[model samples]
Every structure is written in C-alpha cells, then in structure tokens.
Target chain A: MSQPAIETHDLTKRYGKARGITDINLTVNRGEIFGFIGPNGAGKSTTIRTLLGLISKTSGSATVLGYDITNERKEMLAHVGYLPSEVFYYDGMRAKDLLKYAASFYDGDFTQRIQDLAARLDLDLSKRIDDMSLGNKKKVGIIQGLLHSPDLIILDEPTSGLDPLAQRTFFDLIREENERGATVLFSSHILSEVQNICDRVAIIRDGRIIETQSIAELRRTAVKRVSVTAAGEVPLNLATLGLPAGSFAGAETEGPQTSFVFNGDCNVLLSALAARRLADVNITEPSLEEIFMHYYQDGADRGGAAHDSAAQDGAQR
Target chain B: MNVYLFEFRRQWRSFLAGTLTQAIVAAVFLGGMYPMYHDSQKDVEKVLAGFPPRFAAAFGITKDMFSFGGFFAFIYVYLAIVAAIFGALWGLKVFGREKLDRCMDFLISKPASRMGLFWQKALVVLTGIVVMNGVFLGVALWVRTSVGATSPGVGQFVLMALAVGGVQLIFAALGALIAVLAPRLHSVTGLGVGLGILGFVLSALPPMTNESNFKAISPFSYFNVSQMQTQGTYETGYLVTAGALCVVALAVACVAYVRSDVKA
Candidate 1:
C-alpha cells in the first residue's frame, strides 16, 4: 500500500495550563477525504498545527507525506497545501499579487493554475486584499493554497465564509483535487458536508480522539432516535437503559412525550414499552449530526463506542 | 529571495517615508540653524561657555562646538536616536507584522524554513538601514556644501554617518530579537519607542554626569563622536562590542524564531 498522507504516533502538545491536544494518533491514508470533526477548543487546530510545524509538539512525533514534521518541514511542505480557518494576507496587496506571491515560493510557474482557480472560485483577482470581504478573501486563500496542485490538501474550515453556492463550487474543486490523487484532511464544523463527501472520519473531543470510522459505518450505527407519546401511567427507566448523557432530549418524567437516542437492544426496549398505553411511537436511524453530538457530549463512556463494532456488522446487510 | 523582494515591495513606501523624515530633519536643522551658528561662532561659544556645565553636558557636547564637524557632531546624537527608533520599529514590524496582521500561518506554512524566513526579513531591515543612512549622508553633505565651510574632512564625516548607522543597526537587531522572543505582539510601538528613548537617556546620562562608564550601557555611546571627530574612526573595543551584539542577537533571534510558536 502507498504511504498514508499523514501519520501521527501519540502526538501530544500541552500548552501551559491550557487544553492542548494529547496523545492524538491519526492516520489519513492517501487518496481519501478524511474528516476531522470536533467542537471549538477540542484540539482540532492544535493537532493540525502540530502536524504543520506551526507549533512544536510537547511530545511524540508526526509525519506528513512520509517526511517527519519537525525535522523535514521544508521538504514536506513543498507538496502540502494548507488552508487555515482565517485568510488574512498582507495589507494593500491585490488578490492576484497575493496569489503570485504565494506561487513564488514553489518550484514551478503556477500562472495558469492560478487563473483557473480564480475563475472556478469566481474570485476577482484585481481587487485589493483589504477591500475584499471575508468571503472573497477566503476565496483568495483557497486559490493561493491550491494553485500548486499539492499531493495533500489540509483545510481548516475551508468553507466557513463562502456562501452556499460558493461552498458547492469549493467542494467540487476539492473533489477534483482528490480525484487527481491528492489526499484531503478536512476539518470542519458542518457535519452534513462531512457526511456527504468524507470517506472516513475521526471525531475529537476534549483534546482526545474519541472515535475513527468510515462515514457509512458511523451512520450505520445501531443507535436509534426514538420518541414516544403515551397516556397516563407510562414509564421507563432511562438510567438503566444505557441512554447516553444529554441524549434524552428532555425526556421528562411528567411530559406526555419522551424521546431519546437508544443504543441498547431494540427488542428489549419494545417488550418493556409494550405494556404502556402508547398513543404514538417513532424509531428512526440517527443522522451523523446526532451521532457526532453523542460522541462529543457522551464523554468517554460507551455512548458511541458501545455501538461501533455492532455498526460495522450491521452495514454488511 | 522572493520573500526579500516581496518585503521590499511591501515596505518601500514606509522606508521612503523614513528616509524622507531623516532628510527633512537634516535640511531643517542645518538649513535653519547652521548658517546662524556659523556666523556667530565666537558669540555662540561664549554663550555656551557662560552656561552651566550640567546644561552643556545635557546636550552631549564636550570640547569642540564651532567648526562644521562640531556642528555635525551636535546634530548626530538626535539623528541617531531617531534612526535607532525607526530601526527598532522596522525590525519589530518586519519580523512580527504577519502576527499583527493575523496571517502568520500564511507565510510560515510555505516551503521555506523559519530560519530562512528570518534571514529574509532581517535582510529587509538591513537594506532599509543602508538606504536610510545613505540618504541621510547625502542630505548632510548637501547641507554642508550649502553652508560653504568644509573643515571636517570627507572621511571623518563618513565615520560620523557610519556611527549613527551602527547605533541604528544595534537597535534594529535587538528589536528583531524581541520580536522572535514574543509569541505575538499587539502593538510594537510602545516597546520600540520606549526602549529607543531609554537608550537615548542612557547615552545622554554619561556625558551629562561626566562619567565615561555610563557609556557602557548604550550602543549610542559605542561610537564615540569625539573619537570620530579627532581620529576619523571608531573606538576598537566599543565598536567591536556593537558589531558582536548585532551578530549574537541576530543569531539568538534566528534560533528562537525557528522554535517559537506563531500565535494567531
């Protein structure tokens, strides 16, 4: 097999009394759109920074495109395209000047590549960087970061500022790059986009990698979003049924309706609720958003992990 | 190489402004005051002699005060201070402007190493200093010719200019060092200007107090103006220390910058 695009072994970065990443072991294989999903302050940026050599890791090691990040940054960055969450270029420069300046750092002439990307992203190359709105500047950054046609593209919230239509074009561009054999490690807050395009994904929370699995496997988990409406005297013990913390969605004891994400046996839940005078019931597969919430809010317990192995087998059918 | 060229393209306006400011200071000072002082040389000396020694010392004039060289020496200290301040701010901004712009990741993520980037930025500062001094020297020479008195030899005049440039270099190098040491700086003006004025105070203190030892504290005193006036050259020890300080500070800055984090 070809070498993975990125590999980190127990990579850790500890800020002084701040929550930096800890023991982050990740492997993004070549030619895959790998998603890095985490909430704000969840160490996603820290991990990406450590890999990019923007900050020194407190311990452990990481390699990008087979070159050690710490020791071989120059050699490795030659082939790596990075789009930071914020796009702030030098002041008083035009979009084309910024792109040309970025191109000057590489080996080949990227004039045609830059023109192609600016057209594709619908960016005005002659506009001054200071005059462009946030979205336009982000488009400039996208073109600047991608014109080199790198072997691996690392984007941190690359679609944050773009409008819906621009985001569509941006995603299409990324897909084209991926099809050209560029591995992509995309970190973003939008789970639906991750669900729509990512082949495999990793979920990070509280500075740790909570879970890593394929998008299909993650969506295929046995956890069900179940809601029920029952008459008086209806009952259920949520604590004993292994419903995740904050997963009950206000499944109040006195309310007429109760809803929760259930990861336990469906038959057991059904048999227990059979005695109730139920008026309405709904059980459906949870979206990736719901599962991502479970992984983030459920802590280190078996909230999501309990169904991980089961989900892989469930996908077979 | 591209980084260096880009820095020049980005900062040529600022550098031109700095150079113009120095030229204007020289023009106004020499153009407005030099001829009046030249005609009333004896009268001015008598007035200066009648003044309290402490007040005279405050102006950093020790022995000679009549000739064009002495006149040139009179303005060198203040010019050097201004140059030093400009260099300090230039160094800080050149090295850390990306941080202030919140765009460190944009350049630091390139294929170049951090040290390579540091040297390129440092070269920009050095180039600016050369251009600033070059323009200042030309302006001072033009002012001297207009005064129609050329007592100070060409070499001595050049030494005085070099001394000011050297002082500016020290401050610029030190400023670059401070920038690399800081993770990020919001406004470098406070630190740059504060330290610059402090250096001026320290250099002035020794001459004001009649203590040669105070000269050890500031690079401004490193190029003894009297030595440049008399011998047409710099003192070997202080000059070597000044040069060494730049080398060491720049070396340390490169090492620190290569390891320091670029904060957003």
Candidate 2:
C-alpha cells in the first residue's frame, strides 16, 4: 500500500492538567477525504491544530507527508494547506491582497490559480475581508487554503457559514482535490456531509476518537430499524428471537394499521415475523444521524477502548 | 525573504501612518517651543540670574537656550514622548495584531523561526522609528533656518536623532514583551502606556533629586539632550546600558512568545 499522507502516533495535547487529545492515532492515505466528526468541545480542532503545529503537543508524535510535525514544521507546513475553524483576516486587507500574501510563501503560478478558485467559489477578491459577510469570508478562506495546491488539506469546520449551494460546491472542490491525489482531513458536525463526502469517518468526543469506519461498513454494522404489525398483541419475549438486544415498544393500533417499533436487526425480526402471522411489515434504513447517535451516545461510555478497537478495525480494513 | 518582505509590505501602510503622525506631533511640539526659547534668551544675565552653578551643571541649561542646541533640548521631552508613543503603538501591533487577527498560525506555519519573527519585527520597528525621526529632524532644521536661528550641524542632529531612536527602541521592546505576555490587546496597550508614564515620571523625578543613581533605572534619564549639545556627544555608557536592556527585553519576549500557547 502507498504510504499514508498523514500519520499520528500516540499524539496527545494537554492544556495544563486537562487532556486535550489523548493517544490520538490515525492515518489518512493519499486521495482520501477523511471526516473527523465530533460535537462541540470534542478536541477536533485541537487535534487539527496539533497536526499543523499551531499548538504544541504535550506528548507523542505526528508527521505530514513523512515530515515530523515538530522538527520539520516548516517543511511539513509547506505541503499542507490548512483552514482554521474560526476564520479571521487582517482588518485592512482586501481578499485579493490576503491571497497574494499567502501565495508569497510558495513558489507557483498562484495568481491564476487563486483567481480560478475565487471564480469557482463565488468570492469577490476586491472586497475588504473585514467588510465581507461571514460566508464570503469563509469562501475566501477556502480559496486561500486550496490555492497553493498542497498535498495535504486540513479543513476545520469548512462548511460552517456556507449556504447549501456553496457547501455543495466546496464538496465538489474537495473531491477534485482528492482526485488530484491530495489527502484531506476535515472536521465537521454535520453528519450528512460526512456520510456523503467522507470515505472514512472518525467520531471524536471529549478529546478522543470513539470510532473510525467506512460509510458502507458503518451502515451494515449499525443497528437496524424494524417495524412489524401483528393481528394480536405485540410479543413480549422478543429479545430471545436472535435479534440484537434492544427495547421492543408495545404495538400501536391505528384504524386499520398495527405497528410495533423494535430497535434491532430487521432481518432476524423479519424471519420471526415470517414464521408468525403478520398483517404488515416494513424495514427502513436508519438515517446517518440515528447511526451516529447510536455510536456517540453509547460510545461515550466506552471511551479510549472503543476508539482503539475501531482504529484497529479500520487499519485492518 | 519573501515572507519577511510580505509582512513588511502588508504592515507598511499602518507603520507609515503611525510614523507620520508621530513626526507631525513632534514638529508641532518643537514649533511651540520657539516662543519659550525666545523668551528665555531675551537677556542672558536675566535668564541665568537666579540659577545656581550647580543647577546649571546638572540640568545643562545655560544662557544658550536661544541657540538651536538649547531649542533642541527644550523640544527633546516632547519628541521623546512622541517617540515613545510611536514605539508603543508599533510594538502593540507587531506581535499583538497577529494574535488578534488569528494570523499567527499562518505566520508561524511558514518556514520562519520564532527568533526570525522577533528580529524581523524589531527591524521593522527600528526602520519606522528612523523614518519618523528623520522627518522630525528635517522639520526642526527647516523651522530653525526659517526663524533665522543658527541650526546645529547635520552630524550633531543625526546623533541626537539616533539617541532618540535608541530610547524609542527600549520602549518598543518593552511594549513587544508586554504584548507577548498579556493575553489581550487592552492589557498590552495598558501596560505599554503605563510603563511610558512610569518612565517619564522616574526620569523627571531623578532631576529633582540630588542623586544620579536613582535616574539610572529609567531609560529616559540616559537621554540628556542638553549635555549632548554641550559635550557634542552622548554618554556612551548610558547608551550601551539602554541598548543592552532592549536586547535582553527582546530576547525574553521571543522566548516567551515561542513557548506560550497561541490563543487562536
């Protein structure tokens, strides 16, 4: 396998005595859009900052494009384009000037590239950064990060202030960058975007990654939603039917429809329903949000153990 | 080199504006001192009548207040204030503004080392102070020539301006240190202004006292424009001491800045 574009070994950051990100181990291969999903204050930004060397790590090591994050920060930074979670710019600088200033650090035909990016992102370069709207500022940020065409792109909450149309455009841009062999590590709270764009997702909570899995694998392994209708009352001993353990809420009787809600694998319940008399049956795929909640809710208790196991599973895959 | 140039260009406008404002203020203060010089030199004997020889030796204010040298001394206090303010403003912005704009990440991410950033900003601040003092020196000469007063030679004026620049750098370095240590701009500005006022008060107090040792603690005490005019040179020991303080302050600031966690 080709070498991972970004790697962290037992990466940890501590703010005084409080753990920021503990024992964070992950890798992103070239041309992959890796989503870091987490709630607020979940150390998502902290990990990104550590990787970029914006904040010093308390222990462990990280590398980008095979360059040590600490010792070779400058060389590593040269190959990485980063978009901070909270975007801000010099007060008096025009968007064009800001891009030019950023481009000065790299050697390339960055002017045409920046202009092309600005046109595609719908950002007006003539406007002062301070005077632009938040969404426009974010667009300018995206342009700056992608203009240099670096090998690794680290975006923190890249779609926060973007409209739906612009968000889609950004996703397309990210995909194009990935196709060009850039490795992306993006963090976002929007699960749907993660589901749509990410090849693999790492769920971080309270300074730790709880799970990392491919979309298809997560969907297959996630708890299934099964609904059933019986002519008589709902079965009480549903747990013994080989279905993954979950609550079996009592049946709801409509005018002609009787439905039961069971939080478990729909296949096992369907077989049981097939054996018995059923007026109606329906099975729906759980939404990404539901699957996310399932992991995030219970995974909160499992902590680092779950994270290590999931990372191992992902590595094996 | 490009990053340094870029930062210089990016911040040049603000630097120029600040330096020009300081120059204009210094010019105005020097212009205002014209009337005082004329009044003091109206009669040499009358001006020196009540003054003791010891006071004259201490303050270096002779009957030559009418000349360009005395007039320069008269305006030195105001000029130093202008210099201190300009230095403080530049110092506050050099490192503090990067943190405020969240651009520190971008700057630090570049190939530039933290020590390099410190020196670059210091050089920028020094350049600004030079330009500002150059403008004021030119204005002072022009004002003296127009008023039919004997202007000091260019070398003496340059020496005085260089001394002012050195004094200004001490404050600038102090301001930069404050900005690095303080968490917010308000605190940095407050500390800078507070230190300026404290230095001014201390410099003024030492002259009122009989002891010279007490004045050694204040940077302003090292800048004696009157003595420089009479002796045709500044005290080398004092200048070296002030320069040493500036270097130590900047070194401490760089160390603190590199180690501290960036708030952004």
Candidate 3:
C-alpha cells in the first residue's frame, strides 16, 4: 500500500519523427486521484497506452502497482482497470454477457457487483449492445471496467458520450472508489473536470509534461493574459520589450493590438506599457490555455537562461 | 478456453451458414445431375466437346468425365474455391473484428497474453472450417452412395473430400496472417474473395500458361483430384508445400500478433 500507484522514469515513445511523449517523468502516489490534463494531441492517450502496453515505448521504464509494465504485463494488468475514451463492444452481445466475459478473467465472482453497477449507472444489462444508445453503451463500458474493483483505475477521456447526469454519477463513483483505497489516473482535456476531483495534476503540452503541482498551487500560478491596443505600431515581437527573459510568455500581435500571457512582476509590465501612447490595455486572468502558454514559454526560457523570478499577483481565476 | 467458447457462441451461426451452403450445393448439383449424366455420358461428352479446349480444361474436364470420379472432380473444383473463401474471411474476421468494432483497446487490456488470445481465436477458425467441411464431406459421401458412384473407392472419395480441409486450413492461416500483420486492412471480405478466385484462375491456367510454377503459389493447385482418385492420398510434393505454408503462416501470425502493438 505504501508503493506508488504508478511510477515512470524518463518514459519516452517515438513514432518515427511523429509527435510522441518525450522524457516523461511522473509518479502517482497510492490512494490518490491523479489528474493528467492536456489539450488535444498532447500525448495523454499515448502515455496511457504506453503504460498499458497497447503501444511500445522507444526507451525508458514504467511500472504500475510496483509491477514492471513490459515484463510483468499480465500480472500488472490483473490489478488495473482501464476505460478507453471511445466505448465499443461486440454489437451482437447482450450487455450482461459482455460483463460476464470481462469478469471471468478475475478471481472472484462479479455477479452482485455487476448488478449493483448496472443499477447505479441506470444501465439495462439485458439489452443487446447494438440496440443501446451511445450513452448506454458507455455505461456498459464503465461497468465492464469497474466490475473487478481493480487496484488501479485508468480513465482516458471517460465522459465524452455520457450525459450530464451520467457524468455526475460517474464522478461520484470514481470518488467513491478512491475513498475505498483505489488509485486513479484520470486523463482529460477539460481542466475543470480535473480541478474538481484531482489532488494533483500533471500538465502535458506538445508531448512533454510542462508543469505538475497541486490544484491550488496550479491556480495560484503567476500567469496573466495581457492584451494591449496602442495608437502607434504594435511591437513586432515580445523580444523588443527588453523585459527579463523568463518574465513573459510569447506574444500574439493582431493589427494594432499585441496580446501575451505574462508571469512575474505586474508592475514591470505596467511600467513598460506606460511608456507607449496606450489606447487601451486589458489585463485579465489567464485561461488554462493561456497558463499553458506561460508554462510552455517558461520551459523554453529556463532551458537557455537562469530564471529566479517567482512574484505572483492576487488575481483569482 | 473461455475466449474460444465466447467466440464459438458468437460465430456458430456463420459457420452453420457456410456448412449449409456446401450442403445445398452438393445436394442440388451432385444428387440432382449425377444419374442423368451417368446414363447419357456420350451425349453430354459430345456437348462438352463443342466447348473450346481451354474452357473445358479450365473447368477440369478430362477423358474420364463419364466416370463418377471425374464427374465429382468437376464439381469439387468449384466447391474448393468456396471453402477457401470461407476460410480466408473467417481468419481475418477473428482478429479484425475487434478493430472494426473499435473494442480492441478494451479487449487487449485484459489479463490474457496476446499469444493466448491468438491461439484461442485461431482455434475458433479451425473449428469453423472443420465443422463446415465435415458436414460437406458427409453430404458428398451420401450423394455418391445414392448415385452409386462405382469407380473411386470409399477411401479415394474420403481423401478427395478431406482435401477441402487442407485448402481451407492454408487459406485460414493466410487470412490470420494478413489480419495480424496489416493494421489498416479495409475490405477483408473483398480481399478474401479476390484471392479465392485468383487461386482457381491460377489452377485452371496451366494448360494455357505453359505450367511455369504458377500453380505452386495457389492452394487450389496444391492437390490433384484425379491423383487422389487413383493414388488414395495427396501428392507428396504439394502435401509438403501445404504443410509448410500453413505452419509458416500460423507461426508468423502468432509471433507478430504477440509482439506488435494493438493500434487504436
């Protein structure tokens, strides 16, 4: 129980010049709901697939429940329950039959468990899978994944086809399982979904983990989205401002306005903008996307130069 | 074993369909026409002689066409192609069904090893072929005895019927190989049908193509019904080829499936 739920050291996968996860180092402690947040094509699925042995890794190592993924795959899988993003099953099979087939792999009888799950999810076990709606099929997938009560539960975009009510029920189920001593790795592109449930999150962008922190710490990150509309020509790039290298994120210039996600001393930015004949300046809290850009730039700037600025404003997102 | 039973449950209907097709074809074509053709051999020969030599040869006609052995061989030639088609698609369907259904990730993440999955699923294909051709052999024998096919002994007729099993086995292994190796293989049925017809065309073309090892690659060419009628066993050369092909195909499929990634 003291062992981490998952541990990966410099885990990397390369798809022959295509974008795959690179130098991913991560650890999920036992009995924790660890969020894996990223935008689309950010390698969340690839990382999960690699850990599950759906895809092979080019280099590095990973283990789940203290079992080596590649060598002890079968033993490792025995303790893992996975729900793929898209739910699909043999269409001709009744939902009950598919769940029974899934349960046969585990040691204990899941008959009562399946019934309880089916009742909780409002799923009809007797319906043929083809005749079921997409949401119903998803419920079947959920039951199949959870019937064994595996030690580790890995969900990749688990709520896409579910209704809002079902989503709420699903989240409640996950939290219930977490309380019952199960560890979860919840992968999603939706930030709020992760923020609401996860104790800690690892943010991935362009196949690299850019930031990993507690939910509160992530919210408290000193990143701001600043858009400036000046009467004069907008600065061609953020580099011409002569601000500290690590203090600001990359900028986007649209016509007479230049917008950038900024981090660190707000007064430095205000004083820089004060020198220009400013028509308007809007400094608002950054979106999760904007915060990602801030971290993305921080990764680049930290690689080339020393960065020590840690000033944060009192703005709430 | 659980996987095999689950697959058998899902696939028995399709297997029965294949068996039923062969039974109907055998009952209608052989049971209906054998006595008439037997009574008026010369008249039918005269009509068949009017056909061009290549066309007659392509359909496996020879001087012994009046005999029960030759008559059965003529019908069997086309039936073998049907069995091959069934074998190929059944093989592909066993592996490709999950991918086509988008349930590969869920099924693959189960605790079973890929090799375990491969063997169990492959057992289903072998079982289907045996069931299909087993019923087929029984029908053929029943028709032959009812029509009183006199020349080819029971041993020879049984050997000839069992040759369909050989053809099915080779094509089934080939189909599984394609499924395990090719991730994006669309239209598995189309490819199966195309390859089945190609085998028949290749076997029928030696008289025109000057017999340049073209038949070597075709499962249809791997057995001679006339030879089976006379010798009571498959040819040693083609028998070796079929065994080698089936072994190599199934072995490669097992290894590749076990090692390769299950693409989503």
* lDDT comparing candidate 2 with the true structure: 0.74
Among the numbered candidates, top TM-score falls to 1
Off by over 4 Å in 2: A230-285, A300-317, B10-67, B110-112, B137-157, B186-195, B230-237
lDDT of 3 by residue, A132-224 (tens): 988898898888889999899999998989999999999999999999999999999877788788998888866777667777777666677
Q: Which candidate leads in lDDT?
A: 1
Native-vs-model 3 lDDT? 0.83
Could you tell which candidate, 2 or 3, scores higher by lDDT? 3
Best by DockQ: 1
TM-score of each: 0.89, 0.85, 0.87
- Tens-digit lDDT track for model 2 on A179-245? 9989999898888988888898887767866667777776776355455555566532455455554
Candidate 3's chain A scores what TM-score? 0.79
After TM-score superposition, the amount by which residue B142's alpha carbon in candidate 3 deviates from its true location, in angstroms, is 2.1
Candidate 1 or 2, higher TM-score? 1
Error of 1 at A248 (Å): 7.7
Relative to the real complex, the DockQ score for model 3 comes to: 0.56
**Candidate 3: tens digits of C-alpha lDDT, residues B6-115:** 88888788798888988888888788877788788889889998988877777887777667787777777778888888889888888777766768887789998888
Model no. 1, DockQ: 0.78
